[model samples]
Target: MTTEQLKLRSMIVTALFAAIICVLAQLIIPLPLVPITGQTLAIGLAATILGARYGTISVLLYLVIGASGVPVFAEFSGGISKLIGPTGGFLVGFIPGTFIMGYYMEKTSFTFKNAMIANTIGMFIILAFGTTWLKISADLSWTAAFAGGFTPFIIVGLIKAALASWIGVLVRSRLVTAKLLLPIKPIVKEESI
Candidate 1:
């Protein structure tokens, strides 16, 4: 296939995964000024399957949709108001998480240990941005913000990271073995005289 075709296919997958994540967000568990949802699992899956840049764009697209009154976020809220809400920091965090996971996955072996490390680091990046934004938006001190934004999800994030790593390793191995996913570079033809 042509490079353009490959790129288009990747984009389509990215969007599909993002939309799926949005749908998962609707299954919410309300907490104190926050909510728990399965969206991170989708984020993990997307980054694992799609790679970094495309994965990030996918999550950004999901954010845009949720921010536009799409009824796709956790707790069935939408529009820019959701973006500025208390949990907005976590919503915003999805972007970098997807990117970091996707990017690192591409360059590394899909071993369980390495993949888990990469996924964990990716989650940390997300939490860092999320907690920082939460502090600012909520007018809380750093410790308070971190407590509010990061504590509830710490265990869950670790769980999701391990799950994502497993999925990544399995999916990538199968795809490679089956020759299902196209390589990044086009094949070069040799001229034989």
Candidate 2:
């Protein structure tokens, strides 16, 4: 493909992943504040497949859409309030988490082990930001925030992370083989004395 074609393809894929995250966000189990949803899995999938730059773009697109008063968030919630609301931290965290996951996936050989580690780390980033935001937004203590935002979601988060790692990596491999997605170039880092 020509450079322009490649860029177009990348843009299309990034937009598609953003739409996927929006659709998946609707699958919500409503809770007091932070709800359980398929968004994390979708986010992970996008990051793993699209790599850091494109993956982060996809997530940013989703956030922009939601912030623009589109009802693309959990339970069809949107607007600025949703962002400043109790669970908004999780939404903000998505950017960093996606970038981290995608960056790691690209830097490594895209192995399952690496995916798992990256996804786990990304999950924790979400939790950290989400829980902190929950505490402040909800005016809860740290322990209460952990209980409400972090603790309740731990098991489900792990499951989503695992699924995202394995399935996203598998799908990426297939797409690369089919010449549909660009292959990630492994990044080499040199340690300085």
Cα lDDT tens digits for candidate 1, 27-87: 7777775676888877887777667777788789999998989888887778998778777
Q: Which parts of model 1 are misplaced by more than 4 Å?
A: 175-180, 184-193
TM-scores for every candidate against the unseen true structure: 0.84, 0.94
For model 2, state the Cα shift of residue 127 in Å: 0.7
Model 2, residue 94: C-alpha shift (Å):
0.2
User: Each prediction's Cα lDDT score?
Assistant: 0.77, 0.90
lDDT score at residue 167, model 2, on the 0-100 scale? 92
lDDT of 2 by residue, 106-192 (tens): 888787788888889999999999999999999999999999999888889999989998998898889777667778779789899
As for candidate 2, its clashing pairs are none
Query: The CA-based lDDT of model 1 is what?
Result: 0.77
